[model samples]
Target: MSRRSILRIAAWPWLIASLAVLVIGFREAIFLTPADAAQGDIGRIFYYHVPSAMLSLVFPYVNFLASLAFLYWRRRDPLKALAADALALAAAEVAIVYTTVCLLTGMLWGRATWGIWWTWDYRLTAELLLWLLYVAYLAVRRYSATGQTQTIAAVLSIFAAIDVPINFMSIRWWRTQHPAPVFFGGPDSGMDKTMLPAFLWNFAGWALWGTFILIFRYVLERRRQAAEQEAALVAIEASLEISQ
Candidate 1:
């Protein structure tokens, strides 16, 4: 079978697996997991909120690395550069989706726990900035001239990645309305033992879902590139016939 055929077939299993895992994780998180002593039932939002936020960062880093590879290989190896560019675009789009979820869930959780839906604190501000930067990245990629779009978008992706670190470190670096880190915030930070399993299941499930989305996006991008190339060839041939 052709490579495209194989990829199309492979995507189905990944999609099914991701859906199954996410459904199970949702059940475990919402029904099986114990509520927090402090935040009560509202704390249940943590299961989905945290995982989405974490993956938001994860995929932006993926985009940055892919952008770096694109920049390095762009002149020397067109095929490698194209693959890297496609991966960068796919990662950026997926990251935006995750970040949107993170922001909305965070707002809802904040309203429940903090009595407010929005704040200009370090973490919140940084997270908003992260989202805006990537939205701009997508706009640039979408609107720039074909010859320059990939290079410009790659540069933007790399620079925009600086916001990821700021978003991650904001809680540690500055006091905020957001809760302190539960997993890696030194000796005083941790989650309840009972909640760990649910969290892990959700994290694994979301990670798989993100991977499937990324792959699907990459495949679509490859097809788009192929279509563009075909259109360009057709235009060139028509122009040659006209000149003859």
Candidate 2:
């Protein structure tokens, strides 16, 4: 079998496993976990929202790193650059999807818990900025008129990565509307041990699912690149034959 075929085949089992984990996590969150004392059942949104937010933050780093690789290898090793570009594109698209889910779920949770869909809090606004950065990255790749589109997007990715630290530190630096860090907000930061299993399961599930998507997308992009190269070769050959 071809490499792409193998990669495509491999993705299925990972998808299945992630789906299984997601179902188990959903069950644990909805049926097993008790309601929060302060927030009540609306707090269950934590399972979905928190995981999505974490992944949204993570995939951008993937895009940023891949973009850096693309920039380094673009001229030195064109094939490697194509692969890196494929990975970067895949990562950015995935980042956008996860960030959208994060924002939507946050809004839903906010509406339920805070009685408002959004506020200009540090964390909320920082996360929004993060989302917009990736959207612009994709837009640049999609619509930029310049031949240096990838280079432009790669530069933009560096700036996009800068926002990640700000978004992460937003809650830590200034506790406005958003809550403080759950893992490191001093002695009383962590969740209950009983809540750990559901949280852990959801985190794992979403992460695996996201990886499967990234790989699947990379494969598709590689195939497209191959097709474009083939078309260009055919056109070149036809032109040469006509001249002869």
Question: Best candidate per lDDT, number?
Answer: 2
- For model 1, which pairs clash? none
Encode model 2's per-residue lDDT on 80-114: one tens digit a residue. Answer: 99999999999999999999999999999999988
Q: Residue by residue across 1-244, what tens digits does model 1's lDDT show?
A: 9988998899889899999989989898889998888988888889999999999999999999999999999999988898899999999999999999999999999898788899898988888888998898999898876788888888888766998898899899988888899879999999878998889889999999999999999989988988998999999999999999
> In each prediction, how many residue pairs overlap at the backbone (N, C-alpha, C within less than 3 A)?
0, 0
Q: Alpha carbon lDDT of residue 205, candidate 2?
A: 95
Off by over 4 Å in 2: none
For model 1, what is the error of residue 144's alpha carbon versus the real structure, in angstroms, after optimal superposition? 2.6
Provide the lowest-lDDT 10-residue window in model 1: 151-160
RMSD of 2: 1.1
TM-score of 2: 0.97
Model 1 ranges with Cα > 4 A deviation: none
